[model samples]
Target chain A: MFNYLKPNNLLKIINKTQKFVFIIFLVIISIGLVEALILSPEDYKQSDSVRIMYVHVPAAWISLGIFSLIAVLSFGILVFKNKNLSLITKSLSPSGFVFNVIALVTGSIWGKPTWGTWWAWDARITSMLLLAFFYLMFLLSWRVTDDEKKAVKISSYIAIIGLINVPIIKFSVEWWSTLHQPSSVNIFTETSIHASMLLPLGIMTAAFALFSLLIFLMKYNTELIKIKNKGLDRL
Target chain B: MYGKKVKLRAIFILSIFFSLILIVFLVFKSLEENVVYFKSPTEIKDLTELTSKKIRVGGMVKEKSINVNQSEVNFVITDFKNELIVNYSGSVPNLFEEGKGVVAEGFLKDRNFFTAVKILAKHDENYMPPEVEEAIKESN
Candidate 1:
């Protein structure tokens, strides 16, 4: 069973998939950027500023999406006793952290002109902050633990525990009265969004998803290489 | 040794399972309410009808329109052609001033005044915050 699950075969598949996905990501991003910036109509009211949504909303979504993936992967490792799942979740951490930071920073920049302040303790903002803090705690824990396996186990637990906040962040606007507006896009209801606007949003979201997959593949490959090298050294 | 390893893995796995469940709960909860967009005075005027539902209003401070009392601050937000008078009772941003763009989040009780729960000032020409920018764009 272990022989059939050879790392080399998995690595080859991941690399090939990553390259293809990367090309798709770039194509979509270029189209999204051009459409969002040039072709999309300037909002009747916001004029040029509406373009920020092309970056802001997508980044926000990716940040949340990555964390959700990490939480699920972490849980799988802990419950199923799968080292591979733990490794994948660990590999996802840096990219997840980077995207979350981007989301928060970009959000603050967009908030200033509309909200009157750069920062607020509103439900949405505060919950995101908490998410960021959890990420930091996980990263710091890695540094503190000397045993690699111990670190992985502890971080996985932390990731799972922190998962509780994801909902609080998402629903912060609804559960409690918040200054942050509620979500515009939902699966069940038809959106009132204009085609021009929706096109760029869709494109950017695709780009972000592809970009995340590409990063995950690269990181996982690097970890695999490191593990192989260690095995060779022991031999 | 195998038992120790398994125990560690179990704890890690259980934590992740619980977290995933929490995330699903949060995402569903967040979907319950629609995020409201902020509209400027000019934008609002062109809209078909006004709903009593909560929304945000964004615009620039009208020159000389600010009236500040001990705790309350009243001002007018103008979007070139139209203006809405806003009454804010909370702390104001440092950059809040005449002629700068701002967003007030709350609801309109009547056509005359917007009672704001939060006031966000649009800072610097090139550097309006993301939330404010998104709000202004979406509402338009």
Candidate 2:
């Protein structure tokens, strides 16, 4: 088990996985794009515009997922004082921010067709905007702090505090009457989803996952390289 | 040295964990039930099936279609090809007007008219909202 924990060994695993994930990612994205853009049946009601769901939903999911991950990683760094863990968390922040912005922008784009307004203060929409701001606050904290350890600690607290918004965003429809529609993705629901639409959505999501992984790896590797160069400079 | 090594290990593990979550999200999102798009009457005629499913419809307000009775407002939406009658009973946007592009969100009733929960008016030239532009372009 300890042998499995070695850095070189772990790096080897990551490198191998990256290659396979990259291929899977490419295939999934291509399939999803084709399915979403062409194969999926036009919505019985919305016609072709329903295609936006493929992009909007995934972007929203990724943004939320990324923020949650960042918070968890930040917590680990603060509680354990792990340098590399902190670096990884730091590296992930910008990407998380990008996804959050994408989610908001895409949601608005989708909204204009459905809501008749580009922006609204509805519970769901407002909470998501708050989540985006939480990400921005975490990113800004790093820029303001000179001490890495202090920054990690403060950011971790901020992340944990910000997590309160996630649940609010999720349950906004039920807790309060909002113009935004309620969740239709619940596992307990008995709705029948068509295969043609499902397939493309699945493929696109896979592609997005792969794309995020590729970005995280590239960013993490750059961070490692930067630290190594700093060490060399010390010599 | 052990501390540094552990830190490196944590980074690897966290990255993998995050990646896995992303993969799962992708799969789940694709499988989830999706919201239907809103279409103009002209676009709806081209669809293969139509029944009780939720949808959005958009078009310009015909000049004589507006009928107001207290909070409820009834109007007809035309895409220059087909027309759909719409009924709304909520606060309207300032820009809502006749002969202007509008999108109404909701579903069609058995009565052969759209019952809108929300209504949006299109902005001006060189500055149309992305969603409005996308919906308009998509129907064409």
TM-score of each: 0.67, 0.62
State the fnat of model 1: 0.19
The clash number for model 1 is 24
Question: What is the C-alpha lDDT profile of model 1 across B47-110, one tens digit per residue?
Answer: 5777777677877799999999999999999988898989989888656779876778887866
DockQ of candidate 1, scored on C-alphas against the true complex (2 decimals) = 0.13
- Fnat values, one per model, are 0.19, 0.05
Tens-digit lDDT track for model 1 on A170-195? 76766654556666676776654566
- Complex DockQ per candidate: 0.13, 0.06
Scored against the true structure, residue B26 in model 1 reaches a CA lDDT of 76
Candidate 2 lDDT tens digits, B50-135: 76766667668888888999999999999788888899999776557787667677788733578888887643222222455577
lDDT of 2 by residue, A81-140 (tens): 667676677777776778778878887876666446778656678779988889888888
Full-model lDDT for every candidate: 0.74, 0.69
> What CAPRI grade goes to candidate 2?
incorrect
**Lowest summed lDDT over 10 consecutive residues: which window, candidate 1 chain A?**
A226-235
